[model samples]
Target chain A: MTLEITGLKVSLGGRDILRGVDLHLEKGRVHGLAGESGSGKTMTGLAVLGLLPHGARATGRIDLGGRDLLTLPPRELNKVRGGQVAMVFQDPATSLHPMLSVGRQLTEHMRHHLGLGRAEARARAVELLGKVRIPGAEEAYGRFPHQFSGGMRQRIAIAIALACSPRVLIADEPTTALDVTVQAGVLRLLRGLCDELGLAVLLVTHDLGVMSAIADEVSVMKDGLVVETGPRGQVLREPAHAYTRSLLDALPGEPGGPAEPGGKA
Target chain B: MSNTASGKTPLPGRGPEQARARRRGAHPLARFLVRRLLTAVLLAWGITLVTFVLTNLVPGDPVAANLGQRALGDPAIVAQWRAEHGLDKPLWEQYALHLQGLLQGDFGTSQQSHRPVAQDLAEFVPATLELAGAAILVSLVLGVGFGVLAALRRDRLSDHLLRVLSLVGISVPTFWLALVAFYVFFYRLQITPGSGRVDPALGGAPPVTGLQTIDALLAGRWDIFASAAGHLITPTLVLALYTIGLLTRFTRSAVLEVLGQDYVRAARAKGLPGRVILFRYVLRSALVPIITVAGLAFGSLLSGTVLVEAIFAWPGIGQYAYKSATTLDLPAVMGVGLVVGVVYLVINLIVDVLYGVIDPRVRLQ
Candidate 1:
């Protein structure tokens, strides 16, 4: 086990956003978190990193390896973030600072967490950009966020997330803002990188089709509670809960048409 | 749909094409500056024209207003006075002569002061510039500071107090505020210095930069500098009150907006220090709007100090304008109008240039 979240409860402004949630992500595997909007899917991701909104109260254990993340001091938590755990947000456009260059954004945290010098960080950032398949990695480094397309910006965001080579990655709807064709390429890159690095990934999204495509294990959530969790094939093909069944049925084409594996998984 | 936008991605070997495209237009900033200069020239010309026409159109004779009824009764003196000022020429010829003198950097003679309008403005402009400059500096520092504090403590007691103070600053009339400040600080409390630029005993500095504080500094006159700075406090605070209010409200909203951006959250998730996130990510983005509002506030402060200047008895351009307008000093009125117009144009140009520097999107566009 790489990350274990047990009985996590979060409340914001006197309202329960996440009642009680449990999730476990294993090394070298992708755990897909499936839910509709306002169903605590994104809240769980924020909770794990202690990046929840202001005035939010959370009570639970978020264990990474042996340390309970919820109990760590801010100084220790800062080391864990971008070093032990990293995150890629939903919309790449606004996630990256508009005023900063792509290379600056990619290398800043690398220098902060890994103690890499300027030259070392630059070389690693360029390699990461190339690894993410950006067409001209060296030239793209100095360019601003607006200079790149949505798909390319998302790829740069991923490169920044993978900069310090953390053990766990949380990607919240990474492909929701891209075109269908571009989405396939980004999803493939995400899966390939996590597998190559043997990192635990918590992929959060509302789309079941994305869950079918890359997720190794699937967890279905509704109204701040996880309804079902199992292997990808069992959950996507068999969906024990009514909410999960309705979610699977709402997909386009056949009931489980797009989710049906074509010789993989 | 962003389909067309997505198609604009740069591929391999496109660097040279991009460079060539840039070369065709020159540097964006250089081009932008050139455009702004041209606009300023055209606007300055328009201001001179309107000032000349409007001053002439005021239904009063400068000859009668200046030389009085006894001089107007004498045809010879009236004709000589009119001819001396080029009022006897055709309107078109008068305008042509005015433009010709302006091109030669002559602002003509002022009937009220019996001196050249250029010389009169030179003496008066420095005082107003010094006063407004100090006011804007004070307002900007206090306003941005208060604005950020208020935003950080949203809905708290300090925020409410600041909000109320700004509202009072904005709504209170300048003339009344200036009077009350002068009365309380100078008359009642005796803490601040009385009106005018400096004490009569100091006898002013050598007319170097026209700004008394700097001239005093340049001359190494610490006594003169202290006196000049002491005299500046009441009037500067009165003039800065409105602007401080304006900037506080604007900056509060601007900072609040930037604090909510997704990039701020992303910056936090990167494990950056709190100070780093606040300055680099939050305040940097907030600065664009703050700069814009501050520029506008500074412009208004420069031109809008007439009431404060009057109440404080400061020998600035506002007093000159009031005297010139009441006495029908056409040349002087036109000169004041031109200076005010040019100040606004120059400030707007600076703000536009700053926009390109702050946001790269502005530069590329």
Candidate 2:
């Protein structure tokens, strides 16, 4: 089973934001889309999830478990979202509904998508929280998002994404808002969840260091196009494109000398 | 991080202990409630003092206003009346006496009615409340509905139409609206009853609640209730229009702002049904400002009722206050001002409590 995107194109307000883009993410692996800001990395993930903003249009084929997501009607697409293909957003601080308890927010999607009873959903929610290493999962269920630290909140967010045991997960800049010390914990959690659940993950980030640590396969994107696609080791060591080399060189303490500062990578 | 990673508990430190100690101290909601209640009490006293001072400042002779032409003809009678009412005392003494009387629940006797101000309020305040309550009900129902509609259809023709309609509703003078309502509904259409609380045909049912429509219902007098309700329609509609306009505008903007938040988009991404997303996420967040505006609007509606009460000749405190103001009945004016201030503070306190309930972050803070 795999989540594949072919020739994805997204235009917002009649302006092309993402030109033709292709990505392949498989079960039991994390595929990282590494790019600079405004390089359309997040848009690619949004396109796969059919979450383009109002007035934005996408022409693409998003294949998930042999079903073409782009062709599915809204009703059918909704069944896929939060059920078979869920997403972890960039900012945990704002991604959660401020008014809802973490437990209610966690259980809502499972109840709606999986038809789980309230009791069953509650039990599963606590289990999911535990899976994310939340302390006192039962007590945490009654607490709102504001009560949690940023790292813990992000862990809860990941638990929400994994509520229905979706085949594919899209984590868009999942650790960008977190402190450097806390970032490793969240990255580790995502990696462990992938390995244990055998879930395919599309890990989008601008940080090459994050991609190097977590991603098995990496796609280097520049200006809405994937410049290089290979195993993380090969691409980092033996760069194929000038943009890819600059991206690697941009990393702190990376060899091959720094390119012209402020130049577009 | 390593402590957590190693699956061992961290060493005891001041940070966590301090946080726990803080949490164990006075709960945030309790603290907030205590602070708000103290403020409300202080504010009520301040309002009473200000109203008393302002009434004293106005250029008018309370003795003349009370005694009418008799004060001009007989100086001895005027002096006796002023002394009896304690108006002969110094301003500071008058204020202290007034404050003492207020503490004892005595608002003083009205110059016009010669009845205790408190008694007049009891007879009139209910009528104003009934009218204002009905108006608020109408405003909430229509305002929230139209606001949600406009927000959902933002920037569309329907949205533009609603915006223009609310603009006109807000700009239209309430007194003028009451007049126009009388002209059209009472004069031309002849659909609504023109004036008074109830028709004389009903034999004026015994006052229980002091609200005619309600009292009529309780007495099972359908004809009286119908007549009372009909009389209420024009004034209620006029009063409701302004609130509806304000609420609709506020609700629309608030909902629009909430709909644009990142959390709303996150809700959509969770595959929540559009209806669920709209109500649970967008509307819930939008309700904070709406509740605030609704509370403030209700306070203003109480004041607005004076003009409406005058036009309809509805026996409410607003009408009493208006007549008292014209006759320079300082005690009655002060009583009305004090009541309005108290109502405003109470409503604001309720709104603050509601904010804490609706949003836990507020309570926790």
Candidate 3:
């Protein structure tokens, strides 16, 4: 399944946050949404998931697997959420319900969307945890989110998003809160999941390095508008937009050292 | 590798040694319970002592109050009465005697009615409990319901209306509200029966339960039960309005806070229905504060029944305490104080235990 968002616009409190954003994601690929803070990257992700805050109005088309999410009723939209599409938030510490056990949180989406019984949901929860490479998945199920490390918690969040076999996964800065080493592991895990499950991932982040690490295709957003988008290697080597070049220049260490970024020396 | 790495990090004070130490000792909850129980006992004792001292310190001679004008004319008779009642003894000696009587389940005697304080409390405490319990039930249902509604419809007309209504409910004095309720519901509408527990025409039930509604029901006197419940309605409503307003405000703020949390958004993004999200995630998270407020509101309602009982002529501890205060019945006043203290302690304990149940973090701590 492919996730396509076209001409997405969002306004909050009479102020336009997202002017006109567009992006596309295909199965078995990672689409990086790279932008600076307040560039509407997160807003685009929220609009796609229908998770905009109160008094915020969104317009335009959000097509997920041939369904127009922007036009879908809330009841139908809910069926699409976590069933056809799911999201992993930036801060995993706050993403999972603090009071609930990991197992319960993982199984809740599956049980609600798939109408799976307790036994079936529990089995799938364990399986999802294992897929996320959480050691001792069965024991980890009974543990709360606080018991896990930052990287582990993000993996659990990903596991929950994957519980119902969603076609599209919106990972909003999934590694931003982790250590550098943990970031690589999470990025690698997401990359592996995209290939293994043929999952189309909308990886929203402000870090161009992250995009270089895993994104197959990249879209550069600035002021709620997509400035440039193309295959990652081509976009990085010969950027059409000057803003993309500056963003690459702003990355730490050597500025514009080589066309191939995120490569270890 | 992740597990081994995490395990290798020294947890500082949370290692296996500490876990073993915890295993050998009483559980945290057990220790907490024991500590709370001890505090409750000490608090109850302090309340009794304070009540005893304050009552004694009040300007007036218990002997003269009891003996009327006769004791004023004869010093010998006054002395005799004081000695007989142990009032002539040292204050500490009298306190010791009071404690001795309390240990034996004695609450002294009412000066006005010449009845044992214990007996009067037995008759009155249950009535107040019944009234406060019913009032709390009303408050919980209406307050929590309106609170959630206001939160969900935040900044809307319905929210504004509920906020104004709760403000009015909270601001209006209980006595005035009770009178208005009586005038409107009983006199004008004729929907509810007049005051007192039940109609004197129905005689009385066997007093098996002390609570008129309960005893009447137990005795199979539906007419008496209906009449008693009807009389209870105005007073209960009058008492409940304050708590309803308080709880509504509390619950609204609590729910609003929880609704803003990231987990609530996650729940919504998970495709869970709005109703399920509200109840399961939002309301459940908000319950800690609501429960704390509820327990406190109930405690205040128990003590606040004085004006409501006086206005409605409900035969509850508040009315009895008021009567005892006017008559300088120190024993009865102290007895009421002791019971109220114990009731407050018990309610707080229940609230704490409920906190553990609602939030596992509290229980684990």
Candidate 4:
């Protein structure tokens, strides 16, 4: 397993938020964590990255390549944050720094993680933007985050996550804040990038439709614990858990078939 | 306060009438200003009423003090003078007179100099403003720099030490700080020219403007302003010290709050380094609150100019107010007080407008 989380416990404001959560993931695979609102889906991702809100308490074993992420010191955790693992957030709109040029934001990681000098970092940033298929990557470098459209910004957010070529990428409701049409595009982009970059993805969202697009393995969570786990195709065809069945029933996918061009599933 | 620029609405559902009502309720900038001005006036009125009453309530007639030994026998003259200044009426009537004079821009005259108080203020206002401007510049540079440092190293000893320093600054008496600054800079170091800007060698300025710095600059006598700046250094340092502490504390806390926000964490997770997360993501949002506090602090510094000016023997409004207050020059005091109050109002108004310029959300609200 590339990433394994076992018996995770999280409490905040004297109330248990996550309880005895266990999960395992293979390399270069996408695992969809499906849950309702306040079902600890987001908190589970945060615990992995050590990004909890104020006054939250966490315990139990979370190992990313045997690093013991939960017990790692802040400095080591910081090293892991943008190096081995990175996260894309729900609201891509607000996830970026507003004032800085795209170039400045994109190059910063290269400098910190790779220890690249300014010239090399800038060159690499433009290359990364090009990989994300951002038109006029050189010009886009000068543009601020606000200049991009919602979908384009998500692409840039994805580009940033790929900068360090991290092994594991945790996306917390990555498409929840986007429009339905844009959500599919982002999911497709994430799926393509995972194959190209050779990385593992932890998809945390309540949207079943989004899960079906990119998720290889699916895990259904209810009340802070995983209730079911199976292959994405099998889970969608025949959900074992009641919550999983309900989640699929709740989502009314596009009337005819999937939205992919030339290949309808 | 902010007003909407983009026509697109964030909220999907609202009837036309309700939206219109929301729009008319008061732009955030306008509301912030209205609240601040109302608060300023209420505080100003209370302070004025207390100061006026307390100064009078102290067992002595200001008119009698004005007349010196001649006050006892010249009852007719005293009554005439009282009626002319509209002081012969009840205490409330006197307040009404003061208010009326204030609204009309007629602050009356200094009884001592027999000079119109408004005219006298105009003569020295420019000079004091120049000095205050210099002090504010110094405070902003030092304060923002220290604040950025403290925030970058949050939870470290430097952050803790800076917080303690700001606490000390807030607690220390302004006048006492001024005294200590003077004794150390003037009495011991003797590096400065000591009091009031310019040497006699500069020959009372070029008279192009009341401000020594400007007059010196206009005449291409950079040397004179340079010397004046030297003299100004110590007092300006003293003037800015407390404000620096205040701004640093506010900025550090504000930046930390922004850093902890989800958006900043997202940026960091994007493989963007700490510098990017801090300067671009965190500090930009943090600036709104920091700028607000900085504006209020700037206004307070303008108001507090009196003590530092007096301590340094600088020719400024505070010194002028003090001279007028000590001599029971009611007209002079009321005039200076009104001007000071208006200055504070204007400063805060500008600050409010700045919010609209910085954040579109604030403008929309």
Candidate 5:
């Protein structure tokens, strides 16, 4: 397993935001954690990378390749962050630095993580931009995020996430703020890139359509606990927990067909 | 949609740039500047006119004051003096003559001191400038330090400490602070000189520039200047403490506001270190308001140190103006009034120009 989270608990300002939760994932796979708002899905994701804000307390073993992430000090975490793990946020418009050229944002990550020099990083940034299918990638490097369309901004963000070839990519509702057409395009692009790069994606979202389409496994969480977990095929086809059953029934998505090979089971 | 706004346009007076600015709803900083400068000039003139009227309305006979004490009881001497000084003329005639004299560099002699108004200013204005300059520099150092520290330690203990410190600074009376500072540093400790820019025992090169500190610095006499600063420091500190408090609070609030913006939160989420997030995202956005407070405070500092200079026995324009009022030296009082008014207006103009550069929304009226 590339990343394994076990029995995570989180509290903020005297309130329990995340109750005990456990989840596991391996390399070259996408696991979709589905939940409604305030279901503790995002909190669990933040715990894996230790991104919870000031005064928030978390306890659990988040072992990414045998090293407990929560236990590592901040200095050690810096060496792993954007190197072993990277993240893509929901609102690309907010996620991007408006004042900086996208090229600098990419090259900075490349130089920091991959130890690439100035020329090497620039070449890699252009290649990453091309891989994300941003046309005129070289010229686009000079432009700011605001100059680009919302879809393009998300693409640039995806490119930044991929620059380090991280072991784990935690995408927190990467397409939530985007339009439907753009959402589909971004989803497809992420899935294709994950397969091509052999990267593991922890897709944090509530949409089952997205989960079933790209994720090999699905973990349905409620109130910060993973209520049901299985291969996508078995989970979608058979009823196990009542909450999962109701969630699947009430789901707005067209009932998903059989999960692909190596899917949830 | 209209190109080159024509006479038929509703706002016919607006030029093409103004029309475009209105369409975009961008900062009409150029227009704003034009309006502000006009207001500043009118404000200066209003202050000058009021000072002129107030001084003339005083019942004491300035012409009698001009005459020596021996001539005070003699009506013939007062009448002769009034006739000679042009007090017999109409108010308009007096104002026009004074304005003409002001325009032509003929400021008339000080009645009490019998010095040319220009000569009195040349000797006195430099002293005020020095005091104000030192006070402003001290405030800038203290205010910016507290502001940056407060922002860094925002919502923390240090932030609270600095805020309380600034409030205390603002609340204390300047005259009391000046007196206490004098007692501690001069009367008790004897660490610094009591008054004036320098000691008479070691006077430096003659005043080629009229400013003792400048002349001393020019002569490579650091010792004299240093001693002068030691004396000036106490009073400057007294006057600047309040300004520092105001600026620190303003800067802290400005930084806090910018730090709350979504872009700042976004920068943090990107995993960029806190230092980068602060300097790049937070500081840049806080600059506009910080610049504003600093500029206005600078003008206030220039004229606001009157009581401090007076208590410290510093020879400056404030002391000169006060003495002129008591002695009823009309020319001297009017001279200080006109100069201070001009200084305030010029400083405001500079601020407006700076505002335009900072945001490009201000324009000259």
Candidate 6:
């Protein structure tokens, strides 16, 4: 395991958001965290980064390569963030700074973590842009976020998350805001990056179809707790928990039917 | 899924919107600016109409006010005075004549000063602009600074203190504040110079921009600048107090809102240092609203300086307008009205231009 969580609990304003949650993500694999909204899947990802909203409290162990992130000093945690465990969020439109150019956003953390000079950071930013399959990488450097389409903006966001060459990536509903045609491209890119970078990825989404596409291991969460965990095939094919089975039943078309293109199973 | 096979096709990032947005980038700013300018010109003409109509509608008798009772008793003198000021003509003809003169850069003659209204404005406007400019600068610096601090330390001692201070700032009456500031700072403390733009002893700077401080600097007269600056300190503070409070409240809320945005979270998630996140992510994003508020604050400061100017003896358009209205100097009143109207329109235009500069999205639309 590149990252491990044991007995993670989170609460905010006297309300429990996550209750004794545990997850393990291995390097070179995609761990899909499937849940409905407010099920604490998003909260779980935030907790790992120590980026919970103000007034929220968390107690648990987040072990990243034997270093406990929960106990790490803020200064140390700052280095670990973007440097070792970067994140890509839902709604790329809001995730990227509107005023800043794509290249600047990509290079800002690179310079911060790697101590790269201006030229070095620029080169790396362009290269990362290319890696994300963004066309006209050189010319795209100076364009603002509003100039890009939704899918293109998400690609830029993914490029930024990969800027610092982090060991683990927590992608929260990375393709939720994207169109159906665009979703497959992003998912394929995430899957490829996981293998190419040998990085542990925690993919948080509500779409089971997305899990089927790229996730190797699947964890189903409901109401702040994981209800079941297994390989992608087993969780989708034979869910042990009643809630997980109900979620599958909620999908369109008949259960055990062959999945249709551009349609959910 | 069957769609997965088609989804394998390469998807270009660029879309119609992107192409359109890119094409728009070339000349939209120039077009936007030109459109705004044309609108401002039309509004300015509209202002002239309103001012002309409103002054004529008022029950004041400019002829009696200027001629006095003894002169009004003589029928010949009254007729000549009326004819001289163009009051003898029909209202429409008088408006047509005024518009024609305005196009020729004439602001008519001031019944009080007996000089051209434009000349009177030229002499007095600079003082008000100087005071308002200084006050706005001071307010922006302190307001935005304290506002960001308040937001960062929200619900803490500093935040509470600033909130209360801002509340007092907003609630306090301007005239009363001006009076108190004058008495306390000038009479009791004697630290700041009393009313007016410069000490009578220094005889002021050679009028270039008409702003004493800048004119003095242009002439390289440090002594004059210092004296002018000293005189400016009290009134600027008095005038800025309300705006500082207004801006502080506005900026705090704006910054707080930006802090809640997803980009701020993304900045932190990228492991940016606390300072970087605050300055680059939080404050930069917060600037759009702050700029908006600041521009309005500046407009109000320029027009709203009457009470402060009265107490400080600063020669600005507000005081000119007050005297003009009191004496029923119709031409002077209209001129001041035009100036005020143009000031607002110009400030609004500036604010729009600034929005385009700060947020590219503004320029495109």
List runs of model 1 lying over 4 Å from the truth. A259-265, B1-17, B21-27, B74-76
lDDT of each: 0.88, 0.86, 0.85, 0.76, 0.77, 0.88
Docking class of 1: acceptable
Per-residue lDDT tens digits for candidate 3, residues B1-365, read 13322324322222463376378697755665776778888988888898889888999766656677855799898888777678889999999999999999999988788899999999999889889888999999999999999999999999999999899989998878988998999899998888887899988788887888899989999999988888888888899999999999999999999999989988888999888888788988898899999998998888679888887788899988888887777889889988988898889888987776666566555
- Considering TM-score, which of the candidate structures 2 and 3 is the better prediction for this target? 2
Q: Which tens-of-lDDT digit does each residue in B1-365 have in candidate 1? A: 22222334455333564686577878756666677789888988998898888888889988888997788899999999999999999988998899899889899999888899999999999999999999999999999988998999999999999999899989988899999999999999999999899999889999999999999999999999999999998899999999999888888899899989988888778887788888888888999999999998988787668988998999999999999999999999999998888888888888888888788777665
Query: Per-residue CA lDDT of candidate 1, range A189-253, in tens?
Result: 88999899998999999888888889999999999999999998899888789888888778766
Q: Tell me the lDDT of model 6 at B140.
A: 94
After superposing candidate 3 on the true structure, give the runs of residues whose Cα lies further than 4 Å from its correct spot.
A179-181, A257-265, B1-39, B57-60, B73-75
Which of candidates 1 and 5 is the stronger one according to DockQ?
Answer: 1
TM-score of chain B of each: 0.93, 0.88, 0.91, 0.78, 0.82, 0.91
Q: What is the DockQ (computed on Cα atoms) for candidate 2?
A: 0.45
lDDT ranking, best first: 1, 6, 2, 3, 5, 4
Candidate 5 lDDT by residue in tens digits, B1-365: 12111112232122475568668775666557667778987787687677778779989978655667779778888778888778899998988888778778877788878889888998888888878877777787788778978987888999999999899887888788888988888999998688876776787446777667777788888888777767677777888988899878988888877776655654544455667667766775576677678778877776667787777888889889988988889988888888887776776677667765544223412
Write out fnat for all predictions, comma-separated: 0.44, 0.41, 0.41, 0.32, 0.05, 0.54
- C-alpha TM-scores of all predictions: 0.94, 0.92, 0.91, 0.64, 0.73, 0.92
In each prediction, how many residue pairs overlap at the backbone (N, C-alpha, C within less than 3 A)?
0, 0, 0, 6, 12, 6
Determine which window of 10 residues in candidate 3 chain B has minimal summed lDDT. Answer: B4-13
Give the CA lDDT, 0 to 100, for residue A219 in model 4. 90
Q: lDDT tens string, model 4, B67-177?
A: 757765788888888887777789887877766776686767788789888888987676678777877788778787788889888788998888888788767877888
Worst 10 residues of 1 chain A by lDDT: A256-265
Residue A239 lDDT (model 2) = 82
Q: How does model 2 score by TM-score?
A: 0.92
Poorest lDDT segment (10 consecutive residues) of candidate 2 chain B? B5-14
DockQ of each: 0.45, 0.45, 0.40, 0.19, 0.09, 0.47
The better candidate by DockQ, 2 or 3, is 2
* Candidate 6 runs further than 4 Å off: A256-262, B1-28
- Best-to-worst order by DockQ is 6, 1, 2, 3, 4, 5
lDDT of 2 by residue, A30-114 (tens): 9989989999999998888788878888887889888899899999998888888889998998999898889989999889998
Model 5 residue A47 CA deviation (Å) reads 2.4
